[model samples]
Target: MSELGIHYRRGPATVTGSPRPRQGPHAGDRLPDTPAGLQRRVAGPGYHLLFGGPTRSWPQDPPLGGRGDLVSVHHLGTQSPWPGITHALVRPDGYVGYLARGTDLTGLRAYLDRWLPAR
Candidate 1:
């Protein structure tokens, strides 16, 4: 799983309702081993803005804090397939719609606008 680098903030606990399976993380892959940690939660309906990084790491982005739909996972840099990138906007259905390699908030916003323009 480490090679795949597909870290799930929420995912399946077991295969088809079976008992919790054991998992071991390889070097630098800080994946959780507990059942609850593996369980994939059903994504809530609607557009959910997700960002990966340490909380309070970007103080300049003040508007980011006001969005109630935003989700933050601090370990994204190490867990995501796109390492060294700062932000990713995931669709509500759980696919990466946009990824920015640096602190380019404007690019991120433009990408979002392209998909969903002002209404």
Candidate 2:
């Protein structure tokens, strides 16, 4: 899988001398096809932001502001496949673009800026 670039991770060459398994989903990993009807929810032309647990505390406006049109938000509640993950940004190709451990908007914003920079 590493050679194919599927669920592959490159760790320090000196540490363990090999790739180490990371917790939760990593970038480039395929989104889990579970919780039923998930494909339908994410069916679209742009990226999808899935949030775990209640999203009442999250800002009502899309995080990207004007660039929100490039990303659609969805609340997964407790149906998230990766436990403890607060959010997952799934790319249009069905692979994870980024993963957040908690309510880390700073990291997410950086990812969006890098990949989907605003005009």
Candidate 3:
């Protein structure tokens, strides 16, 4: 599997337990393993926000700041597994909760508010 593109998504399972053709990273799909150091960093509690490359600007207050302990951020430089993707939010369960191909974080903020609303 490692030989395949990191963005590859397994086909979804059908009601009869057969796999259905699909594409792209969907919510609940298991995140492919990142580099060892990054994997270790996210092995604990909290949702992890991974930046694929150097960002020009980032929010002064990250989403879900009220639950800071439950959120952490990491920069993967150019070695990010998700080629062409700018950001990837991995949930605590090791699934991809969100993904962004551009620098705009509006969608990311909305996703956080909907799922991990700040208290």
Q: What is the TM-score of each candidate against the true structure?
A: 0.46, 0.75, 0.66
Worst lDDT window (10 residues) for model 1? 12-21
Winning candidate number (TM-score): 2
Report the Cα lDDT for residue 102, model 1: 52
lDDT of 3 at 12: 30
Clashing pairs in 2: 53-77
Pairs that clash in candidate 1? 10-40, 11-39, 11-40, 12-39, 12-40, 13-39
lDDT of 3: 0.61
What lDDT does model 1 reach? 0.40
Looking at model 1, residue 48 earns an lDDT score of 38
On lDDT, the candidate that comes out on top is 2
Indicate the residue-level lDDT of 58 in model 2.
63
Instruction: Report the alpha-carbon TM-score of model 3 versus the true structure.
Output: 0.66
Q: Compared with the true structure, what per-residue lDDT tens digits does model 2 show for residues 1-119?
A: 34225642341111111122245456566676667777678889898988875677466775684677889988887777666437777788777767666665776777777778887
lDDT of 3 at 69: 73
C-alpha RMSD (angstroms) for model 2: 6.2
Ranking by TM-score: 2, 3, 1
Per-residue C-alpha lDDT of model 3 across residues 1-119, encoded as one tens digit per residue: 65323432342310111121133444445665655466676788888887765554445455554767777887676656655436777878676767666566776677677778787
Off by over 4 Å in 3: 1-27, 55-65
